[model samples]
Target: MSNESNLQVTFSKHCNGLFKKASELCTLCGAYIALIVFSPSEKIVISQVPPQNSGPMQFIEANRSAKLRELNAMLTQINDALDIGKKRENELSDLRKKNETQFWWACPIEGMDRVQLQLLKKALLDLKKRIGQHANMVVSQGTPTQTFPFFVGNGSSSNMPIEH
Candidate 1:
């Protein structure tokens, strides 16, 4: 009478064919199937094949063993993936530490010649001021279009969040 009822009837008709084929597969394979199906409208249907000529316990045990093997294989694959990711992370961390140590600016610039250090300091200060001005301009101009706050800062150190 209504659209919901029409949809239910159509869904029921569709499930009839699915259940028929599933039963046939179970019969041919000598395997029982326990199925839980859901419709788009959230209606659930559960179906289980009846006990075969062989006992139900044997069928259930075989299913359990098969599922256990599948689960173990999946777990092994996940463990392998995790180990690979950990090794890659360690390698990347080592590379980053090496890179940081190799940088000239990473050392104490104070011990260098006064003129060189002063030039470096002035260059760094100008870069910082320019970056701050750019960030403020973006924040002031972009806030009306977007709700999130986006701020950029100087890139004196890799440890800091902002990059040049």
Candidate 2:
């Protein structure tokens, strides 16, 4: 054969081999391939691997939907956390209000009603009686009586004045 014909045959052989390798690679890796070859004789050869399913658009849409679902799940979790935080805040606020409204003996008596004042007087009298009892007990036990400057007569007075 002439040199030109031998070159054409060699070109055809190599081109066929390249196409086969490309086909093998595409099949093994599940890849898309588009190959175009122009022979010395001005002939065109085209090879393409068809994509699976609808195409890239379908894949992209599915991926987008998955991402949106994930984002919505995250948003729901955040909303639930915010609701829990609000509930906790409301509980703490209620506790604070209850503490602020509850009455204590040490609190200021300026805003007390007449009935409240009577209750306070009774409580103070009861406290004075208990203190006198305790003092008597201590004295009976042979413990020397300690004079407090605030007491008028050895802590035995029923009308012991209470100091604010």
Global lDDT scores for all candidate models: 0.68, 0.69
Models 1 onward score TM values of 0.36, 0.33
TM-score, prediction 1:
0.36
- Candidate 1, residues 3-72, lDDT tens digits: the string is 8889888888988888888877775566678778898589789999753545655676688899999999
What lDDT, from 0 to 1, does candidate 1 have?
0.68
Top-lDDT candidate index? 2
Encode model 2's per-residue lDDT on 37-80: one tens digit a residue: 99887889888865444555467667879999999999999999
